[model samples]
Structure formats: structure tokens, C-alpha cells
Target: MEQFIQDWGYIALFLYSFGGGFLALAIAGAFSYAGDLNIYITVIVAGVSNFIGSQFLFYFAKYNKSYMDETVNKHRRKVAMVKTMLKKYGSFMIFIQKYIYGVKTLVPLVMGISAYNPFKYTVLNAIASAIWAIVIGYISFTAGKLLLSFADDFKYVGFFTVLLVLGILVYSFKDKKKVKKQ
Candidate 1:
């Protein structure tokens, strides 16, 4: 498992961060604390992948008018809500979107549809992604160090600590979605 994390962990982190982020990055941070990964490299990989993922969605919506239009029609309320948030907050929405569960990709795509400047989005997204990676990575790394200290005293205990943190994060996010829907 350590070898796998050392080998393909960053790759998995890249893909997971590109898709949804939050949970996977947090896990990587904990792993880094446990010495299974390098936090610096993990943050770098996550930041770059996150930047590319948002860029791809933004450009796809910007250039692919037909598809975006179809998507907008189908998910009109959600898209409209994002558009409203963009208007209300302006480019600040880019930074804020990374933390929001449902709207991370939606914000970028909506920005594209609204004809936001590509270069500006890229610059802002780069900064925001870096910040997101640093913040999330550090927090989880710290949590792992504290919660996983028990593992240092008794090896197997630390592994379960990591798992417990992961399960809690997953459950909390899922619970938030349910509450928001209700």
C-alpha cells in the first residue's frame, strides 16, 4: 500500500481532484502526514490538475455553444443560479466556487457561457487552485499528525485513524447535500 501510494498516488490524486476534489486531497494530506506521500508534491499536482479541469469546463462551455445550450436547457435552474451568483459576486465566484460541492465545475462553465475573459479566468483559477490545495492539504496534514499520533505508538491504530477521518468527511459532505436538497 505504501508502494502504491508512492507510485500511483499522485496520479489518482490528479484525477480525483480534477473530477471533484475536497475528499481526495484531504486524504492525500493525511497520507503525507503519515510519510506515505510528499505534501509539497501533492499540493502541486492537485493545484495544476484543478486548474486544468476548471479551464476545460470553462472553455467547453464557451466554445461548444450547442452543447452548453442543451445542458443549460436541461439544468436551467442550476445554471441560472450559478449565473446569478457570478453576477452578484463577479470574479470572486471563481475563488469561492472551489469550496462549494455542486458548483465547482458549474461556476466555471457558467462563466464561459456568460462570455467571461479566458485569460482572467485562467489567472484567477491558478491562484485559487493553489490556495485551495495549500489550505486543504495543510489542514488534513495537521489533523493526521494529531489523530494519527496513536499509530506511531502502535502501528495499526494510525491506519484506522486515517480511515475514520475519511469516513467522517465523506459522510459530512453527503449529509450536506441531503440537507441542501431538503
Candidate 2:
């Protein structure tokens, strides 16, 4: 297991973080604390990937108007909600969306469709992704120490249990949100 992580953890982190992965980054943080990965490298990988992912969304939406129109039309309400957020927060919504559970991808698209400056959004998103990576990685790394001490040989189980509980919560929350949106 340790060998597997040492070999492919960063790769997995890159792929996951590229899509605005939250939980996977936390798992990698704990793995780093456990000596399976390097914390600095882990944070860097996640941050860069997140930046690229967000930039991709922004550009994709900006350049692909026909496709975006269809997508935006399908999720008009969600897109409108993101637009409202953008209006309320301005460019800071780049940072704000990073932490939102279900709308991480939607934000960049909304910004793309609006008059948000591409270069400014890219720069702000880069900063926000780095900040998010550091904060989340450090918190999980710190918690990993306590979880390891508490779980003893069952640290893996503890991690899985925690992930499972979070998954259930997020899944249920999304369902309720979906029904409400409908």
C-alpha cells in the first residue's frame, strides 16, 4: 500500500484535483502525513491541477459558445445561481466557488459567459487554488496525526469510515438540492 502510494499518489492526485477534487486531496494529505507522500509536493500537485482545471472550464465556456449555450440552457437555474454569486462577490467568486460542494465547475462557465476578464479570472483562480490546496492539505495532515494515533492499526479503516460518512452526507445533500432545484 505504501509502495503503491509512493509510486502513484501524485499521479492520482493530479487527475483527481484536475476536476476540483476535494475529498481526494484530503486523503492525499493524510497519506503524506503517513510518509507515503511528500506534503509540499502533494500541495503543489493539487494546486496546479486545480488551476488548470478551472482555466480549462473558463476557456472552454468562452470559446465554445454553442456548446455552452446548450449546457447553460439545460441548467439555467444553476447557472443563474452562479451568476448571482458572481454579481454579489465579483471576481472573488473564483475563490468562493472552490469550496462550494456541487458548483465548482459551474462558476467558471458562468464567468466565461459574462464579461469577467479572462486574465484576471485566471490569476485569481491560480491564487485561490494554491490557497485552497495549502489550507486543506495542512488541515488533513494535522488531523492525520491524531487519527493515526487514535486508530492505531485501523487507520485505513478509520479513513474509509470517515470518507464513507462524508460521501453519504454529500450524496444525500445533492439529492435534496436536486429535488429542490427541480
The numbered model that scores best in lDDT is 2
Error of 1 at 157 (Å): 12
Best by TM-score: 2
**Under the 3 Å rule for N, CA and C atoms, how many clashes does model 2 have?**
0
Q: Candidate 1 lDDT, tens digit per residue, 52-159? A: 899999899899989988888988888888888988999999999999999997998888887688999999999999999999989988898775665468777767
RMSD of each: 8.9, 8.6
lDDT of each: 0.88, 0.90
- The residue pairs that clash in candidate 1, if any, are none
Question: What digit string (tens of lDDT, one per residue) describes model 2 on residues 1-182?
Answer: 78988999999999999999778789888888999899999999999999999999999989998899998999988988888887798888888888997789999888887778898998899999999999999998989887657658787897999999999999999999999999
